[model samples]
Target: MFAFYDLETTGTSPAFDQPLQFAAILTDNDLNEAERVDIRCRLAPHILPAPWALAVTGISPDQLVDPDLPSWFEFSHQISDLIKRWAPATWAGYNTLAFDEEFLRQSFYQNLHPNLYQTQFANNDRLDLMKVIYAVRDREPDALKWPLDDLGRESFKLDRLAPENGFANHDAHDALGDVEATIHIASVIRKHAPAVWDQCLLNRDKHEVDRLLQSGHPVCLIERFGAAQPRSYFGVFAGTNPQNNNSVAFLDLDLCDASIIDANDQDLAKAVAASPKLIRTIAINKAPNVFPVANPRSAHGSLAQLVSAHPEFHQRVGQALANRYADKEPAQHVEQLIYDRFYNAGDKRVLEDFEVADWRDRAQIVAQLDDLRLKQLGMRLIFSNAPEFAPKKYRSAASAAIRDRWLTKEPSTPWTTKAIVEKQLHEIVCGEVLNMDQICALQDFYHARISEIDI
Candidate 1:
């Protein structure tokens, strides 16, 4: 059983923030509801709403006095009791783990003793609904990608599927209101994305992602709008290095088998795929964004091509093109270009190349991007709904091109940025570096994207 939580707080951090109100939805499995609760405490002077938080949650300073619960101490006791009794192994909320959990913790710490709520929850199972949703939506359709608030009047109903369903038109920003909403979303997920649900089950068991990948099971990589394009990059696990065997191999190092010279985050790997257990063995690591995962599956061997050719784009204006003119016929390029757009894989500026005399021919190229292709490609490009905050899937065919030039041991020019970035990212994610040949392939990759990017 997973207890879904959402907290409305006075501020933002667990160490510094305080939870003014709270909500929760207990589910046995799938969307099956087990329990529901909503509580609001007396609003304190210092706990007054911050303007930005108020506007986002639609909760206000005055509402705190309205939804009176049994008592502060009593309810705190009640919360502890509920958690101990149900003891849900996983608790998830949209951005709640980071924002809600911290604030709730700090609030409890300030109000209660060191023992009451803090001790009971420090070991409690936790999940981040926002992270999961973002992951799923990254592969979703463009229309269905954004949250309801972002869409504003779109068909997606935030309230209908949320606290309204559990608390019956109760306050939205209150802790309990948000918790109910979180559970509702889980129900929606059971219906909309079964694969993610399955992954959740694995998560409950604390399954390792590397093991899942090595299982050789078909990973959907499905995107929104029913578009799917699949490719497999199996780690060649042969030779003397038993550690790296069955893992991604890089230029000279076997990521799975390579020694962790200096690293911090284990899961956010670099060029190869190795267990975080291995990463913990080394010390050269930094934060997640700085490290970036480097899985063979994550990177493109062809990245170096794009970086070298980026400057050469000016020269291609007159030279005979290859992809577009395949024996003077256009077939796969159009399909490929459309596939790259939703993923943000293709370069937007490249559309200028489609500027030919015949508009009909250009229109035909546009047709190849049909909805299905976009969904598949979008899934590959986006790993999470919040791409900037979270790691993305596709490296924009452009990044792969850049990677090739950077790894040549030459002083980095504009061309080397991609490879350096790729090497760093690959190390962060997979805990390995790029292969020499793969690094060299970036130059060609540059030309390839130039040919296919845009219309």
Candidate 2:
């Protein structure tokens, strides 16, 4: 089974932005639809939608704050329940691993849901169709009609790719429309390039990916760096990151030196850190576009064998990978601290209670949480959803935070601010070609949002 899902969000920052719509379809192994859901919610009080994002998605201000829609808190519960009901399936989407997955994870986190990684746990796995498409394009170029953008470059955007490949009504930015288009493209690949599709499904499981990488065999890794064309490299399992099992190191056989395996710790670390890297890191959990190398060259096999024989070298590589982020600053915002630590069992139980409690009692349940981050987030959630239920201090503090977030002049802040939206609206009106109606809609959204800010 598979769940093809898509999210239409307010902005790109997963830590700060929120999802406005979540649309998904449960499909059989062959991409036959079984069940579907389309969920939407009113905007959170602290969120100011990006003018450009609203323009792109054709979402108006009235739609964002519709009185009839469920609150964001209720919407999160509905999404969580749907996922639980459709468990043990491969959750998939177009470019979901890079974007939608993060948003979904953050949504669960902010809502104080017990399981932040619902998609990856409980026999559930994930597949990013965009990543699979990249592999298919590299290995089976004629499998589908590849569309080119206006600049004459190969286009992989779902809107363009789906229509070019025979999907007649490709709704570009709508969440549910994109989900159906994704399933159509997946069906094409499944039919035309079954081998590629099977390999992608097999690699969706991190355990399977680990086994393959550790089998002392050469594998083909397909990756696209920036705007460059997708390319395939013969890679061998070099090591696994000591700190995170999900992150594994693979030596690019095309660029590696056999002698580097015997280098000292400092030299090997430098080699791992070098640009145009000899070692490429792969996030196994991301459904990396890795496939077995057919008719491997003798030299490639020999290099892979040498790397496998040296366990000490693997340790050093893992250490080097771990050291790469040793100097990085810790996350300051609560949103960015999602992965800092897992909740204790006590907090998890309380969170389970928090979900069922009435809005008036949720504040008391928040006090029972052991994790400070969860407590803070829980208070904010209460203030956003039902202010009268929140403690007076929390309500006052949340209001002040919203004011500073919206009215701040800081240019580098991650969240969308009123001034930033104003500037973006001006740029869109001046530079981008837009009809007068579209222009007015954007302006109306901006003015309405600004007027609501108490400051």
Best prediction by lDDT: 2
State every prediction's TM-score relative to the real structure: 0.41, 0.97
lDDT of 2 at 155: 93
TM-score of 1: 0.41
User: Per-residue error at 9 for model 1, in Å?
Assistant: 1.6
| Clashes in predicted model 1 | 64
Error of 1 at 293 (Å): 14
**How many steric clashes between backbone atoms does each model show?**
64, 0
List, residue by residue over 1-455, the lDDT tens digit for candidate 2: 99999999999999999999999999998788999999899888888888888878887778898999998888888998888899989999999998999999999999899999999887999999998999988999899998899999999889999999999988889999999999999999999999999999999988889988999799999998887778898989988899999998988898876897878888767777888888889999888988988789999988889989998888889888998889999987899999999889999999989988898899799998889999999999988888898879877788888888898899899999988888888888888756788888778767776776654
Worst 10 residues of 2 by lDDT: 446-455
Which residue pairs collide in model 2, if any?
none
